[model samples]
Target chain A: MNLIGLGLVGFSALLLLLFSIAKRKSPVKLRAIPALTRLYRAFGLSVEDGTRLFIALGRESLITPNAGAPLSGLGMLRHLTERTSLSDRPPIAAAGEASLALLAQDTLEAGYQAAGAGEYYQPTTGRLTGMTPFSFAAGAMPILRDESVSASVLIGHFGVEAALLADAAERENAFLVGASDDLSSQAALYASAPEALIGEELFATSAYLGATQSHTASLTVQDILRWLIILALLAGAALKLLGMI
Target chain B: MRAIAVVLAVATGLLVLIGYFIPTLAPIQSMILNWAIILSGAAALVGVFNLIWVHWGKISRREKGSLYSAILLICLIATLIFGMLLGPDDSNMRLLVNSIIVPVEATLMALLAVTLVYASIRLLRRRANLMSVVFLATALLLLIASATLPFGEIGPLNNFVRPWFQHAWALGGARGILIGVALGTLMTGLRVLFGADRPYGGK
Candidate 1:
């Protein structure tokens, strides 16, 4: 990795770990969930009322480490399924890959059974929309435009071009909880609406939203290491500038 | 099998974590990178297979979208043959594919930019709010700054704005976003490692 790139990655990881730990200790909830949850609460109207959550899983993202793995996003999918019991409506898990679709379907199915809500789950809702990003986005637009989606949680490996999907949801007045580990995605998130989840935060969604113990602990470690990296980088940069090396 | 998948996955995860600390471990790094490439390549095949299966099923069932299926299949098979058999090394074949494909893909993608501009216009007509105004203004500025040709006397402007935009957008704005991106990745990896999030048929 280039010096600055490595520095950014190293520092950011440290910061997140630190922040995650401190946040864990606090009883006071940001409720905003780093920004997007508040948007959801405002647009979605009801927290307890049955509302559909749509997750767009990107297939192409798996190729790039910077974008995180598609399977990692599937972990979030599993978490969503597990947490669906707490919500009134089961999330409509959309996948760009059939394998991911099957994984999501099985996970959600198992989760429903685990949550004792097996009867409420529908196989049709959790489906493989298409094999391509544009096709998948086309298939998903109808759900945003036609269906009553209380909150759309797009925590997966999506690309920059799919930003319009989030914009479509916003225009339709749907609460969008979008997350992707792609750099361009973060830029899109910042531009379209700041409610976007950046790199590691996309992975943390299951932990953040579900409030699971392991997720919480892992997030803490991540933040601590991230801060440590940042401090080291700043010092190194300063030393280099002063010709201390 | 499930237990094995879990064990392998956990081992892979731990190796990756440890490998991060031991920067000199090129083999570990390569293994992780290779795994990523293999898994992703496998997933792409899954996409192609599904596409073919779905199209074939549509044709058999005489579905309403069967015609679209025919077009899709023709494109898919043609592209596959062109790519695999002839290979992109053949300039003539590459030109043939690019001549048709590039324009089509570009046109479709161009629709998005059009839609964005159109939507912004509609929003401005409706809202005229501060945030909306800022959004429209920044987009316009970016578009104009990017697309306009700075010839002759305007060379200085281009030189000045290009570096400024590069640093501000690429370095500054990008840094904050990268932080969030790193956090999301670390969390997802952690989740999978802890078995709190099982992705690969793990129990």
Candidate 2:
């Protein structure tokens, strides 16, 4: 097998092994991510204020390579739905793509079923705002303005258009926590969002927020792999300096 | 049942994942990817219908700002009919896309640049941290270095500093983020492949 393929299989095997082990063990202590902590606090604030919470699942398509962000975002959605399912106004999810929107709906329904509040679930709570980036931003702007949303969590694959949504949420005085896998979007979020998740933190949402064993194990694996990569890079640089290669 | 979905997901995922390495399995991967794309496209159509249902409900109930809903419906139907009749590549459809959609999107993008500037300026006011100061400084320096100087270009600031910052510092950070994202993507896909995470419907 080629290096790329070998790497993929090796990593998958490692992740699966880690996941199985994690499932059998007690919860591990994870480093606190301020943004995730803020998000959880926002959920409580939404409940206390009796205001709606809005989540922007972004416009990434599930069939494409860019599905990672939305998938990670859904993990957060699943966790949020469990807490907010019984609220008078449950969290509303707005997605850029249709499949993500449908999945978000299913996730909400599943959350309600798990909570034994399936009758309270409404398909309308999960909305497919638009198919395109700017259109999605435009579609979501009205909801942010009119829905009395107290907290807005935007996590997914966002482009430069994320600024528009962040600005809208700011205008509405909503508590905002934004994260994205896109660098430019992350930079914009750093500036726009009061709390922003940087780099690998987006992937750790399920671990920190949901406390899922699989997600936590995957995160631990990611950390170990990241350290290994850093060591490799450093060694390569050192070898080059010594004219070894 | 959920078990069937998990089995299908694992099977298809292995085929596609293995296909990435083995040359002979490429065709199978391509076919599966194509099927997925088609299914996603069909899902998008369902989303459009969902959008229509939502707006229709708003209009029917005479909800607040239903005028906007009515306008959206009219525009959607008009564009849909126009595209269907003349085809997507036709001059009329292109005109509609170029003249209306592009300009609105461009305006929003332009607005984003201004918003970024505003946010950068206000960063310190919101949180007076070292990162905020560094962010503001870098943004201002980048803006100034990239701009025309009217008289002439500054030497160190325009040449060495900006280039080093852009190519070395900025590029390094971007690469780091890319690596992190790549790792995250692999783990997420692996989760689905192993049936530990079922995003299709299961818990």
User: How would you encode candidate 1's per-residue C-alpha lDDT over A87-185 as one tens digit per residue?
Assistant: 655577777766677666667776666667778766655666666666677656666665567667666666665667777787777767666666666
Worst 10 residues of 2 chain B by lDDT: B194-203
**Single-chain TM-score of chain A, each candidate:** 0.74, 0.94
TM-score of each: 0.71, 0.96
Which stretch of 10 consecutive residues in model 1 chain A shows the poorest summed lDDT? Answer: A38-47
> Among these predicted structures, which one has the highest lDDT?
2
Q: Name the candidate that leads on TM-score.
A: 2
Instruction: Give the Cα lDDT of each candidate.
Output: 0.64, 0.86
Q: Candidate 1 chain B: minimum summed lDDT over ten consecutive residues — where? A: B148-157
Docking class of 2: medium
Q: Tens digit of lDDT per residue, candidate 2, span B78-104?
A: 999998899999987999999999999
Quote the positional error of residue A25 for candidate 1 in Å. 8.8
Give the per-residue lDDT of model 1 (tens digit) for B54-145: 56766788876677678878987887887888787889787985797667657657776775555556665644669667756766665656
